[model samples]
Target chain A: MSGEASKAIEPKVLWGGGRSPFSISYGKIMMWIFLVSDALTFGGLLVGLGFARHAAVTKGFAWPSSEQVFTHFPFTHEHLPLLYVAFMTFILIISSVTMVLAVEAGHRMDKKKVAFWLALTVVGGAIFLGSQVWEWSTFIAGPDGDITTWADNATLKQNFFLPISTEGGHAILGMEGPQAYAMFFFFITGFHGFHVFTGVVFNFIILMNVLAGTYEKRGHYEMVEKVGLYWHFIDLVWVFVFTFYYLV
Target chain B: MERDDIIEYSLHSHHSAEEGVKLRKKIYFVTALLSVITIIEVLVGVFISRSANEGTGLWEAIKMGYIVLTLIKAGYIVLVFMHLGDERKYFKWMILVPYILFLLYLIFIALNEAIAVGEGMKL
Candidate 1:
């Protein structure tokens, strides 16, 4: 086919052959596709959380509010509701900003700026992960001590009491709590924390490459951009997680 | 294969100094916007008291507002931080539309199943 004839073909022909229809690199397109699937995975988890929460609340269970549960901040005995988690959210966001700055520097082929920003991104991710570990431990420990109890598993049916802290102390069945609340809290945030951990590793690897002048030798920094996409996706996921798990 | 021949690598050019300044400004603006929204959400979550059985409408309204604000934050992250906004229109929609539809379906199914479970328990 002549060039003129191919050019005259329908607009659908944009995806017909050798050229990239999306105007993005193959790596980038693949990254985005993976991100979309990842997002669905997270969405499923959140939706399940919503279902469990609704069922528990409708059954007259005074489901533990986030503000009530996440009241501990490091190095302080004061009752600070949701303060530490909010601080964690800011850490993730600042990491995201640094990541985008690295990508922008990549576009300009500014090796120094890119490395600086990428290092900051890694540090931010590490801090967030540490904060998550602290938060999870605090949650599991509860206000007084180990908050969950396991009961007899007779007839292959496991029974348990999931304690949520109230104004006075922990309570069991018919109290203000839902077992699934504690379960979902760990599951969803743990999942997002895993993402942050992965993103940190990825950013670290890319930062090393930048230090080694790999992209500089390659004449472009699309690798940085691809990893930046993943970093930002972590932050984006945290937005929803923070909103649903903490705020709502 | 050498990346020099790849269309994707060739697609971007170095930003001019002015463009760099503008991009930095936009990044700061988005960061500020995200921070403000987050602070507002935190304040609402902390300060607002929702008693066990009182002012149901206000609580619902606050919940809806929270969702909207969260969505706005998500949009800015994807569009600006992820640079999805710079991509082609079809590419943008291809990435966005599916998530929106899936989220709507998820919400519907979650509510439906939860209601069914609740009624079954009542019985």
Candidate 2:
């Protein structure tokens, strides 16, 4: 075929056989595709949760503010605020940083360095998963003591959510709409936590592969880079969950 | 056997201990930035909402502030941790623009629904 006619007949970047289009490997591109779709799933959950939150507030329900509801601390028995969850977020992000570092090391073909960073990433993910477990237990256990509920207006008169008991402890005097609030909170955060749980398991396998010199033999730690993408995606997801579920 | 030219070694600077150090520094900086943002958000939530009436402008502003800060953090994570910024502009926009547009549309519909739900409760 003539050059002009051949060019005219050929499709551009998207349809070009084996063309990466973005210089990313097919594997990385596929991972990106999956991540983008996963991101939409998270977006849908947050949007649905947002709608429920609005409905609860507008329907004259006393939607629990995340600040108060998640004030749970571990030992102090006093409201530790979002301290623990913030730490969890920090840990997740730090793990992400390590994952990226591992990928960078892999690019350099430094198997030892890759293993070092990947090991740290695994530790970070483990700690984050552990924090999730603690948070979930506290959430499921409910506030320590008796519980009282009032409508939104009645909330003004009784502000004590966790009344300190002279004997053991007073019940949580939450506003009336907590059941609905708890439902959304539990569902969305639970799903995110499940992802974190799976991510840690996934990272552990990658870590084992690294230790086994799998990537070293392959001449590059591209596997670490691919898993790093997933790790960072989890961390990115948590940023939204923290924003939508806790902050906003 | 023919060599695949596409599988060449990474063209970035050869591994230097300095590069490792620089990477560590960047990670620490990102961690610090994230921590600061989280602290400010927590402080805003605790102080403003606790002190002001929930319906007040200050409280509302703080709530809005949290969302904006969150978007900023999300953008930062995508750019840095996900290395999306390293991508070619075309690829970056192709992946990101649609998601942004979709999320904005979803937010718009959701807020409208919320307002409607609230209004209906007045009946």
Candidate 3:
């Protein structure tokens, strides 16, 4: 009876039926789909921004130059334009490099190295978020002059406004107010910053896991690899933001 | 299972591990190239803007050029760094084709809407 039980037949089962062509590893495939959805949202925001600018132009409101609008530092009277934004871009790029190194270390199962790289990535991300806060504050402060001038080829008109004078005496030209740009700025960048913040927090958790020897117990750092995917996606989004918002 | 099979498997493992290192180096080299191109694009944009003020045809062309360079950078990042280039062909099309089509649709709708809004504001 024991020999018969040991040699008992197994039931037949079908394998690999109805598999998805879109499938990679679970984490990677999900990231791709998430990116696709996120791209749509960003496209909508950019298109809306374009529409707003066009409307302003048609209404004889002058578009503020990118250089002019983003020209202030926290607690400083000196105005700087592309320099600060370029610094922010550099910070984000360095963070991306740190993320890549973390993933590399994870592949080798070097928990200590992964933790170090992830820590650096988090610090870089925090610096970027701080810079973004400063940028937004500068943007919302608005221009200085009470009267903004509007001009086309044919005519020049002066529009009077309350002297909501801030620091520099540059006139706030075009539109009813800076509220439109300010709102969009906060919304789009805030959204992106939130993602960066989450990525940092996620990296921190993985770092903790590495420190706790959980990954060692599991004998693999697949979790670290997955989190790296999220980190890289955040960096990719920022590249697009820098291109469209600042450079273009 | 056989002695030769074990030897072959060991050799394959050694070869693939070396290949992986080479692949990573290639990816790094491409990333550096992309960074250089990005700097070039930014410099060109600055020079073009300085030479031709806003609303000039050259300024418009520069703007278009900036967009093109950005797309190129994006393509390289996805293809090389993200390993999309090494992915299965069907998977690549499944992800990219829809994205391009949707982006084009978005551009069309956005431009039309912008024009309409511009016209309305003019009126």
Identify the leading candidate in terms of TM-score: 1
Report lDDT (Cα) of residue A135, candidate 3.
71
Q: What docking class should model 1 receive? A: acceptable
Instruction: Write candidate 2's Cα lDDT for A149-214 as tens digits.
Output: 332323232333332123446344432256556566667777887877777787789889888988
| Cα displacement (Å) at residue B28, model 2 | 2.9
lDDT of 1 by residue, B88-107 (tens): 67789999999889889889
- Sorted by TM-score, highest first, which candidate order results? 1, 2, 3
TM-score of chain B for predicted candidate 2 = 0.79
What TM-scores does chain A show, candidate by candidate in order?
0.83, 0.79, 0.74
lDDT of every model, 2 decimals: 0.79, 0.70, 0.62
Top candidate by lDDT: 1
Model 3 interface CAPRI class: incorrect
Q: Taking the tens digit of each residue's C-alpha lDDT, what string does model 1 give over A1-248?
A: 00121123356766777666665667878999999999999999988888887776766565666776677798887888889999999999999999988888877788999999999999999999999998877655535222232222232121334443344664534322445666787789889999999999999999999999999998787888889999999999999999888878
Clashing pairs in 1: none
State which candidate, 1 or 2, has the greater DockQ: 1
Tell me which residue pairs clash in candidate 3. Answer: none
Task: Give the native contact fraction of candidate 1.
Answer: 0.55
